[model samples]
Target chain A: MERVPVLKIGDILLVSIQIDMEDQTALQLQEDLADRIVETGCHGVIIDISALDIVDSFVGRTLATIASISRVLDAETVVVGMRPAVAITLVELGLSLPGIRTALNVELGMALLARERDFEFKDIDDDEDDADEAVVAAS
Target chain B: MALSTDEVGRFAGLLESNGDALTTAWTDAVATLLRGRLSHAELHRQIAELQKGFQSALAGGAGDLEADAAGELRGLLSELSNTRARQGFSATETAVSIFALKEAMLTVLGQDGDINATTLRDYVSFSAFVDRAGLFTFDSYVRAREELISDQAEQLLELSTPVVKLWEGVVAVPLVGTLDSARAQVVMERLLQTLVDTGSPYAIIDITGVPAVDTQVAQHILKTVVAARLMGADCIISGIRPQIAQTIVALGIEFGDIATKASLADALRHVLRKADVNAGRRGAGRRES
Candidate 1:
């Protein structure tokens, strides 16, 4: 009945899985993270798996599923703190987690998310600037 | 077919008395096999020590060569085989040393002026014992040589897969020689460790020194790229020669979405572009601040 705790920092949800996950627990986590993403309307999620020593296919798939679901919820997911051994194993298992963004650590993960947020803001500003130019042209 | 204590004692005494003659014959045989390449004095010294050990052990233990008495002889033979292997002697040359001692011992026994069935039986058993010892030496020499070969191979592997940091946020692994599975594993582990240690976002795998790129090699390269990608660092495979590109296409091996370049220079230019983007971002942030 153990659950992975999800913490919210500003609009970012941080999930540091400190223990090995049971199959049921991993499934439960997928649900919990999705619900939290909607409830908090977070802009980014950083799932830290540095403490995870072994990532079997089941856990790898669960991670990929979580990243995909978070994307659908309008939140960017950055999986961070993967040990080198785990990364090698995940590749050998042929589960590259293609859609998930990854970073070296939580700090870098946060920086990446902030950079992404900056790009999003700049995109919105560009749209506004174009709208202003159009209004002036029409007048 | 066990020799009585009396016969074993007589054989031991013969070995002790004719030790120099036996050493001479043994060296002569080894000289034939080695084409006189080895130092005669060193060969003589080794044979003298082996004869001393063999005679003493035969006198102390039971008459049978198969008993624990031959343990010392086995040890001597093992050491001799190991030395010969390291000294570049062939298996036949090493076994000749023991077999030659057997022949020289028989000649000494014949000169003792005893032409009887029991002595001849003892001689035959002794000859068989020496043959067994020669075979044991040959086995040890082969094993030692194999160990030496494998050790050299491991050192070569460690030498070939060196990951170096080219810039602050970039590392490169220049591969040479063939890309077998074992070397591929080493390359992947070393490159991944370097990526983690440097925290470099870019890795350039230069395969210019690689002789050819077959399907299996392409698979290994792709696996390494995927592994690096999972670790959050992108990999750029460089050194794609025209022949290798044609081979890859002919084999229908897909490199997936990983980036490839024709040369290291092109790969470096690609990394610099990305590095410039990052640098430009930091500069923009500073300007705004």
Candidate 2:
């Protein structure tokens, strides 16, 4: 089975799936990704599926599994570069792909992961909380 | 009943000899019906063209408009009706104008003073042919009107769903009027496509102009938000009126985790600050207080 490659940039690992991931290949990729996260001690994982055409229920479940696995391994998973058509198809199928963080592109994914880190570190704590609450309540 | 070959020949011969008088009578009757909306000269020219079409078709022995020899006549009839349709003439007026030709031929034929049963029978057949032509004009007028309506509907669909840039990483879609399924689909596709094109992280859907918040409209909005979320963009729905809010609560519609705002400005500010937090921009510095 062909393996999906995992590249590390800074503290984030990028997984750009360029092939049609068979069930076995996807399982193997999950295993490989978990191993890399442990080996590099990275805090963020970004999955780029912009080139992917069809994302059925099987793909949705697989992505959710990947996200859960990353969370359990102490890393944030952000799926980036999803095509609009695929997103619409997934929604029409009623699969919201729970447990996955998404970004418009790889750049935004990195920023999201960075922000996630900031939220953890507790530096801008009180102000961020206040603004977040105001956004929810003032509207 | 279809006109006989010799009857068609008589029509052609009458048009050749008394064409000027027939066209003038036809134009006068039609002009009176139209109430002078069209210029006298333009009306004269159109009547002349119509007469020429009939003259040529009869000369070719076209007993029926459907016959191959009357191809030019069919083309001219459709073209006249189409232009008149666009120019806002009623279908009845156009059909009646064609019917005026029958009366014009009757008056001209009477001037010949050759009154006989055979001539009256021939006139009856000619009147039948003109009635068919008038009905044909009505059909083409209706067809042209329907085409114009559909074209405008498509244009309106395109115009109504515009996704505009709100900030560097934010976009907005201001929706107006009724939120039908078709328009909802258009809004969703355009919003998502703009999200991809500009890589906007946040989108604000302003529905202030939306007259009501029915279950279906809310469903459309929720589906759009969910779809955009799948593509890694946040959608904030803004511009909810007080009445709509009460209706939404009454309906027990769950917006889930999607954020809603009371106005477009609030939504914009909300997204901008969130974007600042993500990009680590100075927009976050205001929080130092």
Best by lDDT: 2
lDDT of 2 at B187: 92
lDDT of 2 by residue, B168-191 (tens): 888999999899998899899999
Candidate 2 stretches greater than 4 Å from native: A1-3, A20-28, A123-139, B1-3, B113-117, B250-252, B276-289
TM-score of chain A of 2: 0.86
Clashes of each: 0, 0
Tens digits of per-residue lDDT, candidate 1, B1-289, equal 5666777787787777887777787667766767777778877788788787778777875465567877788888899999999999888888888888776776677776877997788788777767777898899999999999999999999888889889888899999999999899889888988887777889999999999998888888888888888878889999988988888999999887788999998999999998776655544455443
The DockQ score of candidate 1 comes to 0.43
**Candidate 1 Cα deviation (angstroms), residue B230:** 1.4
Q: Score the docking of each candidate (DockQ).
A: 0.43, 0.46
Please, what are the lDDT tens digits per residue for candidate 1 over residues A30-104? Answer: 999998888767778899998899889898889899999998898999998788788888887878787889987
Off by over 4 Å in 1: A126-139, B1-7, B62-66, B112-116, B278-289
Top candidate when judged by TM-score against the true structure: 1
